[model samples]
Target: MTTQAEKSQQALILFAHGARDPRWAEPLQRLQQIVSKQVSGDVLVHQAFLELMTPSLPELIAHLVQQQVAAVTVVPIFLGQGGHVRRDLPELITQLSADYPQVRFTLAPAIGEDEQVLKAIADVCIAQL
Candidate 1:
């Protein structure tokens, strides 16, 4: 009987497909650490890669369940909606939901079109131009 409201107290999990270059993951991990620090609540932050790195989505979700979290939010750290975000992520959520029936989990949209992202890109373009 886990309602959406009850799930709000759960931890958040961000899924990122690791880059071939090791440095690529560093920025995302740093961002995660920053968010974990800034958010004021009983929340847990975790990172999982579709490729490379350790602790895939399933593993992280399993860990969250073991911790008896009220809910788990899976946010895809993707630039845009694609096959992985659109298809694969949904499939993973469905499977995870089935596996952990006691713990509620939610999937957030991809962070593709943020205002800050647009401004950052515009600044880069302006600098180049």
Candidate 2:
């Protein structure tokens, strides 16, 4: 069983494929903010991008490791299992795992794969028509 201290040492990383435009990161950052507030103080929520953005995955992981975060879950904020999500991400995770052997990094499915997100997207589409 996981104790409070164990949970406190865990972090959630909201992983996203970044765009060149700064504005592209606003929603993702906002999401990190929202999730951070909702989770227990034991957990830390962060946003990291695959490319064209600051705080790349490796960078964030390095910082978190220094902060003594024991475990991490990476939730890809992508809508589909594209190349980035399917291939690049796994490679990155592999390297990160090798680099930070002490930290546990788990990758969750891409956000769009969730039923809730699909339903919400459908609702928005239906409302728009």
Candidate 3:
């Protein structure tokens, strides 16, 4: 039986749509830093963009694979299940799976779909009033 410590390395990718302005990425970058610190190197956390940004999803995945990450969890940061999340992401995953059969990629629902997140947002909305 494989030991707990022998489990394959894993990574978390906070996938988001990019904007033309560089500042738009700052919040995600902050999240990446916070998560990395919280994990304390147990699992790597990364940020990647769909367009108008550097380090696209494919690029980040290739880089992580080179570092020998065995599995990856991609969390779409979009507010809803749009075509990009429903259609484009799956196509990208298919290609990535074919390219790197050794790596396992798990796609998560869009962040906005999480109940706890929605509750937090709602609370903050009322607090702002």
Candidate 4:
């Protein structure tokens, strides 16, 4: 049973591959904060991990569904579309879609593949030369 307030919430989940070291998630946490501030009211941003961390994708999505978030956009904070991004993520989304029929889920491309991101990396490398 979704409340009227819950029906208006839209969420963005920054999905990343987790590490055993807690410090590894600092950057993503910072990203979540930045995104949260940029978005308008009724939009929420969150972080979820693939492994070696708490609140895996499924868990986060489940919570969001429970909260009655109408839509969710999942952005993979990964460098490339490797096995985890290509194989694992799709499988996870499929299961989540089946579980949360009312909520919409969208997957964004891996962050590194963006032209601006690649150019930034190249600029940094060139600066070191």
* TM-score to true structure, per model: 0.82, 0.92, 0.91, 0.91
- Model 1 misses residue 106 by how many Å? 1.5
lDDT, residue 101, candidate 4: 83
Candidate 4 structure, TM-score to reference: 0.91
Q: lDDT of candidate 1 vs native?
A: 0.81
Please report the TM-score between candidate 3 and the true structure.
Answer: 0.91
What would the per-residue lDDT of candidate 2 be over residues 1-129, giving only the tens digit for each residue?
976444438889999988999998999889888999999887889989899997999999999887789899999999998999999999999999999999988999999999999999999999998
CA-lDDT, candidates in order: 0.81, 0.91, 0.91, 0.91
Candidate 4 pairs with clashing backbones: none
Question: RMSD, model 4, all Cα superposed?
Answer: 2.4
Greater lDDT among 1 and 3 belongs to 3
Tens-place lDDT per residue, model 1, 17-68, is: 8877888888788989998998766788888888787688888877777667
